[model samples]
Target: MAPSKGRGGRRRPARPHAHYARHGPQPGLSRLHRAPPPDDAERLHHVGPPVPHPTAHRDPADLCRGQLGAEWHPDFHPREDELVMRQHWSSSGFANTDLDFMLKQHHIRKILLIGMRANTCVDTTARFGQELGYHVTLIRDAIASFSWEEMTATFELNAPLYAHAILTTDEFVDIVNDGAGKGSP
Candidate 1:
């Protein structure tokens, strides 16, 4: 007897079009092929005002690039027009980054967090956001994790204790569209 077809019965054929080839660079080509080396101004723009380090005299960009090397540096590059901020200490966004300052500057009293590793970075950031007096909302369905158990733990235990609200992506979007404005926080 033959096995019945199920959801994973067959694989679909690969698309004929090369998406990147049509839109941008060809496959196996370096994205930075035509990019210029980091100049003084570019470095300053990315790294922000120098913090007091043991080697305060050395350029922070040079130091970071030297320590991290070329491959790692490329991974840290922000997309065009994206605001990149550095975080140095705990998993909390506000602990070492300028997130608190930015929030205060923009008068943002609430934050919506969605990201990878629900148990670690997301949870920590949400906790810190609450501690910092912001109304923190975790978009539960939008987060990811390696283990179902970890996801369950975050959503069930830790998130309820730390976060002001736990919402699915659709629920959160609906609320926003229904005129729950920014000032709702």
Candidate 2:
């Protein structure tokens, strides 16, 4: 989904590289946001003027290097020039992150989604992106859920409703690398 003029006349990025959102520092562990301490943890950097949902629930996405810090595993550290937006909400990455900004800055309109929270984070992000007129694609093999039924429901039943295209990682790679559809890879 590179540099394509997608639905609503929005343009997708020429490259697939995107800012990491909802990639961990998972809230399931009950950690805190990265800055401003846990008491008033309601701010998003690089997220544009007036952070959405000012009166948000109390849940920060990081706690420094604490045992229960809201931080991604060391293996998932952000690469140079990369941004990792911490989602304040459990389901949608757009809730408290700069995902929208990154997408717009890079002219991304076609969203390719993958990750572990197929039924939750992935599902919510995809649905919301579609609502905002982004062409959403789900990489089936790249996503998972807490349960097999959840995975099936996400990719098989519910995804058809919002996802513009659904493909296995291999199929997508084929399209990008080979010629399933050019301009990728």
Considering every candidate listed, which one attains the maximal TM-score? 2
Superposed by TM-score, candidate 1 places the C-alpha of residue 153 at a distance from the truth, in angstroms, of 1.1
State each model's C-alpha RMSD to the native.
Answer: 13.1, 13.0
How well is each residue in 90-152 modelled by candidate 1, as lDDT tens digits? 355666678678667656667766555577767877888788898887765556665656666
Superposed Cα deviation of residue 183, candidate 2 (Å): 5.6
Residue by residue across 1-185, what tens digits does model 2's lDDT show? 33455346643222222212234423311221121211111122222211111122263323333435344455434445445664345567676666877777766556666665577778888899899888887766556555656765676567879988876555565555464234431
- Count clashing pairs, candidate 1: 0
- Candidate 1 TM-score, true structure as reference: 0.55
- The model with the greatest lDDT is 2
What clash pairs does model 2 have?
Answer: 32-60, 32-62, 33-60, 33-61, 33-62, 63-70
TM-score of each: 0.55, 0.59
Q: Cα lDDT of all candidates, in order?
A: 0.51, 0.52
